[model samples]
Target: MKASKVLITGVSGFIGEALVFRLLVDKKFIPVAAARRATKFQGLCPVVSLDLNAPEAFPAFDDVSVVIHAAARVHVMNETASDALSEFRKVNVDGTLHLAKKAAESGVKRFIFISSIKVNGESTPPGKPFLADDVPAPMDPYGVSKREAEDALKQLGSETGMEVVIVRPPLVYGPGVKANFLSMLRWLSRGVPLPLGAIHNQRSLVALENLVDFIVTCINHPDAANETFLVSDGYDLSTTQLLRQLAAALGKKCRLLPIPQRCIIIVATLLKQKAVAQRICGSLQVDINKAHELLGWVPPVSIELAMRRTVDHYQDKQTK
Candidate 1:
């Protein structure tokens, strides 16, 4: 197959950086890496400056055939903005739709949007996981922005005949991971005894590699166009199971003390950290059956192996 001229936003982001390398190494995509700073992807791939907030500066899309959009105002905890939703909408909703509209007019063949499972809800009830077809009930500003973007993109696709593929992935963790995932790795690496042994909530996660693989699949698969997908590693693990598995992967002993879930939640609540509490005690899972049945896409990495790779990358970072 001929190499596609793929424009990848967020080239400096965690997932975006990983995608750039895969696109190069796989030799399937001639990635036009777009970022606010051209140096982000300098010397690695063809770099272009793209400020989503400034549509006037958006590079011409005449040669681009596919666009993998990964840029957005990601979720921030304890956000300091006075109007958080307004801040998010500026980049996530308005910025995304603007880019999609331009891509559609520029004759871009496909637009693959990276969305979040939080669009389904914060947590899932027992024995029921999030599906792509579920009505969105976003609980936070970030999720609301993504939900709105999806809707706008769907409408744009219908009106302009531009193929749109929406992918809602659960927590994505891997090498160079940051925020909560990185904090967890740091805590585990130092042998901190977490009081999360009693947590029985299952959370689905996708490996960075697995997610990029699926994106590539969507780039070419005919059935993937104009479809929404919920993707995971096809394995679910509770907090206890996750910590234990991560410990094993890091070649360390699991150190978790079984404190009651309510106790943990109460302490977190008193500390004004209900969101953190929910993450620890709540369940979040996504079903990838649609990706499997429709796109014939199975996660290329097993959870165990994925964890090992992630731990290895973390270890390498610590040593550096």
Candidate 2:
């Protein structure tokens, strides 16, 4: 029997790149990488340039067994675009629908979408975590676009009989990471004393390796079809704890002042950075019980190990 061919979009991204490596190492699947720009890819697999916005970018899906859609208009802190929502929908919604239609027409068996936890909501109510089945209350344009794409994907799957599996993950951390996670890691590396000590709010996070593992499992799992799942490190941590752990991983002592959370929020509001402040100080936890009961999947890497790998990679990059 031949290995099934899996199409991975956004193959150059941090999560996508990790997923690609996982698929390549598995003898049961062949990963076909697709991205908007030219990626080095290290000649690991067949690379194809795909423009999600272009109808002509459709793949020869006849031989493809699965489509793992990872490309999307992600969140931007300071978006200067004229219409942020429209820009996001163009690629995140319209482009996604176009790809799914082409894949369905070409007889692809499964479509696995890598969604974000932002689709669930930004922050959870005190002590209560966000569940997979909870109603969506998107707080930002990026989240709104993701919710739209998810709805469209499920509808398309229902009409076309394509197995659509949605996996919504929180902040993902690991080697070659970027964005806020990268900034956090860089800050920890400096061993600077900060004023985030009073933060005891729980926030969920997933390691890059663990997320890729879950995605690989969903490829052919019968139970994963048409189901949405949320994943994490099987552990939630407070902002202070996370910073301390990160400092430990970098072999530095974390210096955190026990500043009041209310004070921090007030400062953020004054600076017009309430959203940013909330991310650092608010609680956003996810319940992964659905994923556990349905897929029998667990994150392979622990939080401590994940942090070590992340810091090590950061150190290596700095040296190079």
Candidate 3:
């Protein structure tokens, strides 16, 4: 694949920001970033204001060879079920279809979609990790929306001649990360003893840098077209192990209380917080062997390094 112009949506987001930076550094390709709000990275690339939900809002795909769609409504608590489904369809599914159609119309070569592992399922069974070929059984509105978006992209690929690549990442974390991951980091920083120590369930996660690398590799990888991949850091850790690693990264001794899982669940059930308990104690893992065999891509950073970088960013933010 030759160096070509690329258009990336949600360039201000965590994965998007890292991706744009990587693209900017690549001398072969020129990057055009599209988002709803203006970004401080104006000097990095051509920034275009685009509202993907608007029917008339379509970027100039004429000169672009690849379109990387990374924008979506990602908050779990900020939206109701109805609102989430509606917004996800408008942005994740409909917006994706619109762009893919335009990409096909404009003679774009490839369309890469950044999807979530939740599309596979929220929690994996006892000993089975999610595989790329497994049937999608989304557990939440957000996952359903992503699965729909993937279906729409696949349909576009079949109807038109455009190549589509879908990459599903699990729990992406690194610098500039927000949401639940950040909350956990804050708790660790406060030296709070969390009951999560009792949960021995394993969860898979990806480093933002590794995810960016995968996205870039998908741009023109011959084997990635019309394929779905489940990506991770190639490792899984329990909640207790995760806190210990996070504490190590922060140069602090781990302070975790191993409260019995059954007791926690019982109390949470009585308090109507079972959902929260499930999120913390559930086991979720992804198998990325297909990605390795197809794209020959491996995570370049270790989990420890990634966590250290994440902690460093938080320290920098606190200092500022």
Candidate 4:
């Protein structure tokens, strides 16, 4: 079946950009990209400026058959709890509800929400990854807000009969990615000795391309309706392993020192950097078996390939 018009919020974001490109190239979905400002999108798509906080900022959805809600205030340290909660509610929850309501009124079919695995908490216990059915225990305000958004979307689904597909993804990185992960790559490329070599913490991460593939698949997948799915590259990595892999991708030797976890934690606490330490030393992993079984979806890109692509993108940007 041919897909009707699709609307995507946060088109200027990392995942949103990649998803928009994929939709334009592969699925050929009629793309409508929305952002707060005018910017250059890689490919041609009907771009619209919409401030999700305002009720009238949402565009007319009468022609939109599917809505991919990807816009969110997604910074870990830059935002206060109150600010983050309000922003998340405005964009992720309220904006989502607004779109869903319009879609239902306009006879739109699906609403795909890009949620975070942080909703399951900062870390999973030993020998167990977060399952799809686990009760949400978000550690920070961002996660809490995302959890609220998910609930709101589900409630909207129940109320309006619009199909809601919630995709909870972990750290998504690749070309054009930002945040601490990219910072680590830059540090590693400079041959800096990271003290996280001894910290054994497993974290799940998804590649941008892989995540975009899943989002595109979910757009029309019948099993996605009213279901929440955790997505990953299906590979878990420790801090040391991740650093080593990153170093390898950059063709640089891993200059890592085996630092004591206690010492690191103590220093971080004394320096009022507990959040940074938690991110580097936490064990957050997700089990994506449900996605595989339900949607018959699997990551087409390998971890090594994903990291390599990221390194290449960074290098090219540097040269430019």
TM-score of each: 0.97, 0.97, 0.96, 0.95
Model 1 lDDT, residue 136, Cα: 96
- Stretches of model 1 off by over 4 angstroms after superposition: none
Q: 111, model 3: CA deviation in Å?
A: 0.5
**What RMSD value applies to candidate 2?**
1.1
User: lDDT values of the candidates?
Assistant: 0.90, 0.89, 0.87, 0.85
Query: How well is each residue in 63-104 modelled by candidate 1, as lDDT tens digits?
Result: 799999999899987799999999999999999999999999
Check candidate 2 and list the clashing pairs: none
RMSD of 3: 1.5
Cα lDDT tens digits, model 3, 172-281, are 99998899889988888888878777788889999998898888889888999889998999989988899999988887777888888788888899998897887788
- The per-candidate count of clashes, in order, stands at 0, 0, 0, 0
Runs in model 4 lying further than 4 Å from the true structure: 1-3, 80-84
All candidates: CA RMSD in angstroms? 1.1, 1.1, 1.5, 1.8
TM-score of 1: 0.97
Scored by lDDT, the top model is 1
Q: Please rank every candidate by lDDT, starting with the best.
A: 1, 2, 3, 4
1-320 per-residue lDDT for model 2 (tens digits): 99898999988788888888887778689888898777767577877778998878565775998999999888989998999999999999999999999999999999999999999999986579999999998988999999999999999999999989999999988988888778877777786678898898999999998899999999999999999999999899999899888888888878889999989989999999887888899999999999889989888889899889999999899999
lDDT of 4 by residue, 122-181 (tens): 887655899987999997777887898889878878988889999999999999888888
